[model samples]
Target: MKVNCPTCQSEVEWSAESPFRPFCSKRCQLIDLGEWAAEEKRIPAQATQEELERALPDIEEIEAMLAQQGDSFFRDH
Candidate 1:
């Protein structure tokens, strides 16, 4: 199989013999790594403080709920 390099978009062979399977060469691979290190590449996400607070249950609430449920929930059949 053949695929494009993530950094240079160059054609690359997908095989064990190809040292850099996803990248055309070490240079392209390093370039992608550098982009990540420099914060140039990022995963899109938006979460306000209020949104996060609402999304996650409080630790105490989680503990209480787990206590109510007991260890039976985790027991293997």
Candidate 2:
């Protein structure tokens, strides 16, 4: 089978002996999670339309808080 590394986007060969079969390496695996945690990449919710309508305000508030603290919380430099 074949898979691509989530981080480097390199081609990954799958085999029993390949420990980093899915992610390319431990670092790459963690990088993907970091992307998720930092919201650098987005994941869609399974909520219905009505739920999303009700959730927009909450999401906005969360984004506002993140914007306020994000520079301090996740500093790149």
RMSD of 1: 16.5
For model 1, residues 21-54, the per-residue Cα lDDT tens digits are 6877654544443433335333123433344345
* Backbone Cα, N, C clashes tallied per candidate: 0, 0
For candidate 2, write residues 1-77 as lDDT tens digits.
87877556666789865576576655454344444444633322343345434433344344455567554543222
Q: What's the lDDT for residue 5 in model 2?
A: 70
For candidate 1, report its TM-score: 0.46
Residue pairs clashing in model 1 are none
Cα miss at 63, model 1 (Å)? 45
Model 2 is weakest, by summed lDDT over 10 consecutive residues, at 40-49
In candidate 1, stretches whose alpha carbon ends up further than 4 angstroms from where it belongs are 39-77
TM-score of each: 0.46, 0.42
